[model samples]
Target: MINKLNKSYWENRYVNNQIGWNIGYASTPLKTYIDQIKDKSLKILIPGAGNSYEAEYLWCHGFKNIYVLDLAHQPLDNFIIRLPNFPKNQLINADFFEYENSFDLIFEQTFFCALNPNLRTQYVDQMHQLLKPKGKLVGLFFNFELTEEGPPFGGSVFEYNSLFKHQFKMNVLEPSINSIKERQGKELFFIFEKKS
Candidate 1:
């Protein structure tokens, strides 16, 4: 399953326009979180960032050090067309595991669930590795039972805690009160600080 979710598979998703996960704008929970940030110079990364509207929102709001990474190239191309002024060097198209950089903050949108469940441990480890000490990983996760079938897989809060607790300090992991209508009951908002 992990092998099948490779670069070509995701590129094909874009090519065929089957990007059901593209919500077309920054998610409200993330935007609200970004609004409270007083420091505009922190380096942030959005992995698996397909047509990253959150990056667009951040850039517009004075967060200029944001980096958007995706395995598929098509979405990054689309993003450049939308935000022509965004620095091209910050737009990365590479395997997340192979990419190396420490970020002060990393935003997780649909990226986690879209990965094959088999790779969740590696995902956690890589996230820990890529975060600066005391750096944060924040954003949303789907609230539902995990099953065998899905690119949009699901998990409970309990499951998430078990997976991330060893390496991250969970500052907040709860049903998001401020989620958009379509995601109101289906999202878990989180802020996890990488352990020192």
Candidate 2:
């Protein structure tokens, strides 16, 4: 079994500033998706939201009802400091699997690859449970091999399809045309709506 990815494990990664997954800004693909979204009040969740630039971007664009959840307090605190007027209640410092809430959308980025591969199915189940009926789960997924050596463990289209096809309507799972230069060919942009 992979080592425990408990709260402390994540907290320490934050405390030490070892979060390479943090892109320091809302990813391009996600920002593009947000730009086209018409609703400003859609309930949205960004789990494993490290330094949540996406949430900040959403807020700046008039989107309320945005929830940013992370296991560590550090990033949440940072977010609070950065956006003092943002609702403190929306900055959740909690485990994703245990948090009980539903949302119209969940934005994914780097969170999936960070977990131990053993938890992929659990992650799927939790996401399915947390989404409102017909809710969408949209984001980028890595398009590489899955291995034991990472917080950024990789995955491919085949693996993603095998894992998520039963529970989600695969709306768009293809090479992201607008990936940032650093991730140009390494990711797949996907829009998966929850199955009713």
Candidate 2 matches the true fold with a TM-score of 0.97
Residues 23-53, candidate 2: write the lDDT tens digits. Answer: 8899999999999999898999999998999
Report how far residue 101 has shifted in candidate 2, in Å: 0.8
Global lDDT scores for all candidate models:
0.95, 0.93
Every model: Cα RMSD to truth: 1.0, 1.1
Quote each prediction's TM-score.
Answer: 0.97, 0.97
Weakest 10 consecutive residues of candidate 2 by summed lDDT: 1-10
Per residue, candidate 1 scores C-alpha lDDT tens digits across 51-110 of 999999999999999999999999999999999999999999999999999999999999
lDDT of 2 at 47: 98
Q: Give the C-alpha lDDT of model 2.
A: 0.93
Counting clashing residue pairs in each candidate, in order, gives 0, 0
